[model samples]
Target: MNKTFKIYAVIFIIIMVILALLEVSKKEVTDWRKNFDVNEKSPFGLFVFNKEIKDLFKNNFTKIDVTPYDYYSEKNKKPHNILVVESEVDQESWNKILDEVSKGSDAMIIATRIPKNISDSIGFYNSKISFEEQNVLKLTDKKYQNDFIELDKFPSGRGFSYIKPNVQVLGKTVEKNNEDQANFIKATFGKGNIYVHCEPLFLTNYYLLKSGNVKYAQSIFSYLGDKETIWFVESNTKESSSLLRFILANPALKYAWWVFLGGIVLFIFFNVKRKQRIVPIIEPLKNTSADFVKSIGNLYLQEGDFHDMMAKKAQYFLNKVRLDLLIDTQNLDEEFSKKLQLKTGKSAELVNEAISLIKKAQDPYAGVMKEDLGRMNKLLDGILK
Candidate 1:
């Protein structure tokens, strides 16, 4: 290969080598984003919970990709218990879930904040821990009613400031102020019941893997009915509306995007490093304005069309008069001659003579030869100048 090609090839190879080394040596970072992805193995991800949830519930646990509304409305299969774990449930899906619930499908929503419709209808709202970094969580069941798990920092939990009397409080947490706040509850709607829990972080991989919190987490899931459950995986949303994140979220597209970025980096590095000499800008050949006028004049002269040429010259002179002198030459009469003289400060004789030639040129019957054309041109030029 040529020397320049060899240099570029070496640079490309070196860049690729560095990138590969960097990627290989990179430390694995613990992703703490609370996206609740069942496939993710991060601290806050639910990968561990998803694997063990079937054994915990004593049912066929499956992660569904569609919304609860779609699963319930479209399919004719037997009802499956639905679990929604999200930071917050939007109103639209909340309404759809309620519709499905009215049809006798049980759904449990565990979120940091309850939907407005649920809060307004059921009167269960989120509450803050009344104390410091740690809170004592308890189950209200007869067997474990007095048992409480102490967590390092329980920023969020289900039982809060208000609980409607109809709903049964299954679990609660005690703060530093010695007041018990409900975090888990069951409320009936139509033919089915919804288990609404305030704290979603309780069931994540961190709590499940650390400090025997798995027992407490399972205690909470025991409240769900004994049936096959479908974890509507839409609740694992990253809560990002960006287009790039959407592309990066898919595995196939994510690698394709990285490859595209690598190509762009190579293109920028090699192309920018090898700069080209300034190319002399050959100025486009100028077109003289006189060339167009000369060509038209020559065509008229060769055709021996003196009358046409005279008509054209008179038209040009009238346009000039209107533009430069601001005088109308439409009539070309005595009044026009007077106005032209007043506008141009020209002699009345010159103006009248020019008007007479223009009138002859404009008239069809007034046939003109080459001699007449020359006289008209000379007189018109004198008046206009």
Candidate 2:
């Protein structure tokens, strides 16, 4: 218990010191627009932040910052409505929001563009551009009645709208063409409410400095005002989990390290400062020179290499016989043939050719062919017989 306490004390001190240093150095989140010096804020702070959005939602909505990192905790919190803030929308994530909203929950999305595939899935009415508008508008056309529910009407020429099943256009862009205008729309999926915003500028830091944006931001939250629970979803999210907390909570994962350490310690204990056990060591006996040659010769004989060796030995014996028989050293072939006929009952031709073959074996590159070796063996056997 005392050792464990010491270990924990050392760990706590180290963590405190590291955290203190981090607190001294403020880092910016590069991808996101830094609003109000994020270095001054907690690393976990900020969800959807822009100067324009901060000013608008700053007063009414409590700053409850949720992120993908805090997904499980926020998921556990079970907010009344979830807001997904993304620069782009993907089908899977969009579908997830829709499914959640279909349960009568509320979800709001703020993005640059929503794909036509998504509109097709939820069944939205497609409208061609008639003209450009500056103020947010309502489509008074009766044909788009089932497709759009106007929250605010554009003042002059400001908004573009599209209609589809279960979806409605709330606001449109006046500065750009109908196809090019930024659109803010809403759709219903299952039991949930989904709000889709076209442009991020209206909620960003730069746009918030403008005059009418505060009202725009207010109107957005007002439409979603009743959602008790809220979430901000980043675009194209796959399921993920928190690593540190997960390992700490799972005992089996933690125990694996202890097991590994224990095995290593046991190995060290067995290896060092351990008593040595005596064992017998037998020395190999070395053979003499004659014994080595005899051993090699016996091996060759057993393995059929002895047949070629025997043929050579027989040829050497014949050479000695040639000297003993007194054949001329230079013309031994014809002279040896006459002497071989006189000494042995074998043919002179066979004896003369056999002597030449054995002499040919003296060539460094020459070797016995399988058939010649077999013939040589037969000749030696016959001569010996």
Candidate 3:
């Protein structure tokens, strides 16, 4: 009972030790998971940070609505007095928007980098201009004044320029550290006016809150008055994921079952070869094999086998005792029994009785009863343990 209690206590302590170690671990957000939920409109994107223009327009403007356009869904909207387009505008979508504006509707497009055709018309590549054109802009608070319209800037031809000859230039390619400063032009198309901004960052939440670009937003809003304003927010949506990008990112396509079969065939032809070798056998020296015998005996004992099982086990142990003590069958008396009992730590009477039973037991092969085997096993284990 005490041995069993110790075994259980050791097992329980091991389990508790493992549990205590496990309690020290903590999990954090991975880069992939963090980047997953980040969208263009997310707080991390330009939408959350730029506040100067948004605040100015939101309070003064009576009717304000926003629509997102991709390659599709850029057509067939009621004409408005003011239009704003940011981000990538598909060729077809912009053409449709231009068509609407041609019908006397006003618009403002802020592109850090204008498209090739539009940029060409505005002489974007001309060396006469003092600045490089790009699509994204970065503006500092010092660069922007109460009159300045801030825009976001990035490298490459991502700055603003004017394609329309009739458009009135607000701020030309100014000699400054800010790459975003470009031809902020206002053009008259038919009966309506169009404002083409080089940078859209002024409208973003970040610039709105930091700089006084809110004044420019208020000016744009005041020009349009209470007229319904349409803000076209472009998104890639369904057409955003390119097939080439998909194929590159997903390598599983290269290792499909058919592909794997083809790879196996190539490998077999180029690399695999059959070879012959000899295997050697090792013979082990004999050692005391009591552990193997005890394991097999324990299995049989746990199965509750009766009759011959107990008699066989008792005979096996009795033979070992006889060999160790050199006891002869004819002279197996009290002195021999006492010597065997002293060697095995068994009671003298029990050892004698167990030996007698092993020698005189009925043949288990001749249908010996299970109850008699049980009684014999009880006696044997009592002496052995």
Best by lDDT: 1
Model 2 worst lDDT window (10 residues): 36-45
Per-residue CA lDDT of candidate 1, range 239-276, in tens?
A: 55788988977756765676678678767875786868
RMSD of each: 21.2, 28.4, 33.2
Question: What TM-score does candidate 1 get on C-alpha atoms?
Answer: 0.56
Better of 1 and 2 by lDDT: 1
State every prediction's TM-score relative to the real structure.
0.56, 0.36, 0.38
Whole-model lDDT per candidate? 0.75, 0.52, 0.51
How far off is residue 110 in model 2, in Å?
1.1
lDDT digits (tens) for residues 1-385 of candidate 2: 4585467557655765575567447574534332322222222223235323434444333333444334432454333576655434445656655656676766666543457676555555333333333434222235432332222222123222546545666665543334434366677776666776644444444434445444556666556745454445332232236675577557566555444555576457546867888978988777688898999878775786534574566556666665665554445467657766676678866776666665645444566665666566566556545
Model 1 residue 170 lDDT score: 84
Ranking by lDDT: 1, 2, 3
Q: Candidate 3 lDDT (Cα, whole model)? A: 0.51
